[model samples]
Target: MYIEKIQSPANLKQLDLKALKVVADETRKAVLNRVSKHGGHVGPNLGFVEATVALHYVFNTPTDKLVFDVSHQSYPHKVLTGRVSGFLGDMEAMDAVSGYSSPTECPEYDNFEVGHTSTSVSLATGLQKARDIRGTKENIVVVIGDGSLSGGEAFEGMDEASELGTGIIIIVNDNEMSIAENHGGIYKNLRALRESKGTCEHNWFKAWGFEYKYLEEGNDVEKLIEVFRSVKDTDKPTIVHIHTEKGHGFAPAVENKEAWHYSMPFNVENGSSLEGPEHESYDQLLSDWMLQEMKKDKTLIAVTSGTPTAAGFTAEKRKQAGKQHVDVGIAEEQAAAMVSGMAKGGLRPVWTVVSTFLQRAYDQIAQDLCINSNPAVINVTGGGVLWMNDITHICLFDIPMLCSIPNLIYLAPTTCEEYFAMLRWAILQDKKPIAIRIPTNGVNHTTEAVDAAYGYEPKYKMVHRGSKVAIIAAGSFYQKGENVVRLLADKGIDATLINPRYLNAVDADTLDSLMTDHQLVVTLEDGCKDGGFGERIASYYGPTEMKVLVGGVKKDLYDRFDLQQLLSDNRLLDEQIVEDVMRSL
Candidate 1:
């Protein structure tokens, strides 16, 4: 009732301290309740609730633009900025307030819709510069995470903002960690500054010529409001270090901040989620596989760009794994070049990056690593927008898009078992930079995968047969496409379906035969439809009479989506594909 009554930030500012604190508490409770029912980034958003409230309450919004880093934590901002119901309805939020900041999708969201860590500071800085050029007078406050500070984009923006000496508020929400615990040289500096009683003067920001204000007590809402009000009228770039416990008020997440950074449905009373076994993550598998390889082959090292945890590489394992475990801060470009050196120095370096984030290192993957034929094993995980949190096209369509290059080799696995085998094969073999764009469940973990060279399978490895049209599937989405086959057979439309295990490596003979004999070729992949393997395959059948229907994703998934609706939008359903096939026939 109180939430509904407060329509705007002006109304929120009118609330007394007791009401303000109560509002903050209720907002937290509401956010936790919403995200827990259908899992979202809980910790980062939770940590910034009070500070976010304080900023909006003190400043004017819509007119006074507030940008969020990666914007996963913008739920509170959405709730305060004329979006009362934006934070609710997890299942419905897909078409509404996205998990990330999306202005194009929704009017309430700002210009940037980001999920990848960092890049906010740069965006805010550019917007501020443009505003100044146009003689527009509105406050620009960009909230960046401590984890994102490790990224080069944030630094570049911060450095540029410092030079411009413009009045922009850079709120550094220092809860720490980028998906997992942050890795690199800067995290150490942050720890020192946090512990130094203000003695640790490693001024990374001042070095760039920005005014700095360090306040480690982010939980104290009153103090935060005062600090925000103090910098409200300042005329140069200013940094506010607001320290808050991630997963604050929740004991479980506070204790193991790394693991509790996000969670699924749970009992809110005890703060314990549904218990489950600790299945291995891609990071853990790669670390374990690397350790085993180091035992056999001494020249092995590992490299990561800030996200060791997302990849499942624990700190202990990184230390104990092999000859070298390099955490190159938030710089993917730097990490790319480092791997090349390791390869030339007679050491095999493996880089484990999530498929979506690997796009940052494309030039390096091509020029620095691929041009030299460096043996770097890039372990990419979380490839598709299967879940509701379709923030952006983190899709791996680009990796396969880069297949036009000369030397690089790409691979994919159906289950967790093959991941180890793939890793072993990648490590032992000498080739140009090898990027294995892995789906979440890359290998079947049961079998002990050893280094055995295997031929790259076609994008669609036909596993079943039917009298009707053939279905082609790629990436982790084969599971869904496989189900469609069963669903079709239940309707008496027995169809042939194949898993394109190697998204990049097309099976020439199998593809040719399928195109000729099959009534329809329905191609499906998780990446963007344009410049993907399916489109390439479609192009390969140049000016053909065969009816070919392609499905996956268009490019950027819009604000609202339903599975059936998405399929309808893409013409992916049986009826659509069959109708198109009929027209071609």
Candidate 2:
């Protein structure tokens, strides 16, 4: 259709308003076609299709930089910018492109390799400053969502961007939702602005030194182009707040906005998931346990930084928990500090976070939570080497960053029983700030009795005790240690398998015991080897006669990679570990 004919912004500029509207329609279809077959962000892209189309039509892109915040909403932008083949072509073509914006893929149009939220304004300000320094005058436009404004960095960017006193247009795409429902006090002002059709008396932007404009019909192609054209090459820093539906065109996504924010492979005809029903997960287990605990104790609360669903607190479940469940919007720093405050106030707070997002709150976690020794339970999901291969979302670095912090006990549970046992202990004990790395591997259960006092008495559990070779595997990699033990047995070498439940510290007593029978100790962790769980083991046995071999991912940034190839390359496979043990022996 119209999308096929248009290759670039130059091609889009040739089309009139009518043709532009037709192209927006076609772009939406292409997005649906691609995302329906291959899983991706659905609501964000569906909502921003018109804005992307209008921006490309109005501006001289690549020359006039257009920076997208998060870049999950850049799918429609991708379809129009000489990459429609990825969306409209075969499965191979779809697999070629990543879900998030990548500079490597399209250096000209996609300004940054972004997957995280609330960074566009800061990034664009840098671009504008550089251009100004070079005596060039290319318009720098930043497209950021209303939910992103809650982040500390976004506020910092806006504050600094206003002081520039030059031409910079910040487009606030008010979709009225983050990954889930919006939170924080900033959203209340956004609601007021939306209700008053941008004529709100109390405008946060105006107070922050920004020339403000508003658009009620954000989905209208001609209207968006007109507003975009008005702000083009302006002398003052400006904010164009545009209100749009989150899942505008799709009925299911429009109705259930949060659930459809990011979709698995789904049926296009009726928005049913093609990936089938979700099985039992650690998130679900945690949600159930938390609800049970919250019922018994009124002061217990569940906290999240925008991604409540990651903790299995769906909208329905959230309503059930009521005020007990807190979403701090896309602000992890605030979540960390607030959870610490909650703990200091004697309220039991469990802050659940994804591994990659935890990077933002490192300072707060160290200074506020750990330093204060706040009695808070931080449940870390997606902590290990994950299936998410995007460079921005890689989870291999959390171990090094987190485990180094003092007064924090990071526990790694291998099974569901052990996980719940650790969680139960972390919640009840008001001693120190404890973070549990929720296992990323498939949900596993153990028939063996799990000690209730596991975290309290931090020690390694020896599963299969034998001879000269010892394998101390942490968390999900404990399963890998089991397979490696079997492989070693096949080679006529009986190996000792140990599960080091805690990541932050080494079990000195267990290691001293291992020295009696074991000579070569192989530490396997589902994370980066350098400064990781394995390194702790290596450091522990440094002065001893025992030899230590650390098995983990190499220290490097990877993007959209094959999981099997990554494991094989890193020697994370059971066979690889067995081979390494053989060589060491």
lDDT of 1 by residue, 1-585 (tens): 556566677888788777878878877876777666666778887888888778877888767888888776787776776665755544555235566777764554366777776788888888889988998878889898888887888778887888788888898887866666776677777777678733577866666787778787887778888889888867788988777778877676677776666777677777666657666566566667677767777777777787776555676776676346677766788888889888877788888766667778888878898899888777766665543336463443454555655577676665566556667777777756676766653344444333357553433456776655777776565665776777666666777887665666567777677665576777877667776768767776657765667776787645435557876777766566656545654
Minimum summed lDDT over a 10-residue window in model 2 is located at: 451-460
After superposition, the stretches of candidate 2 with alpha carbons farther than 4 Å from their true spots are: 455-457
TM-score for each prediction? 0.85, 0.98
The C-alpha RMSD in Å for every predicted model, in order, reads 4.0, 1.1
lDDT of each: 0.71, 0.90
Candidate 2, 141-166: lDDT as tens digits: 99999888889999989988999988
In terms of lDDT, the best-performing candidate is 2
Candidate 2 to truth, TM = 0.98
Q: For model 1, how many clashes?
A: 15
Please list all clashing residue pairs in model 2, or write none if there are none. Answer: none
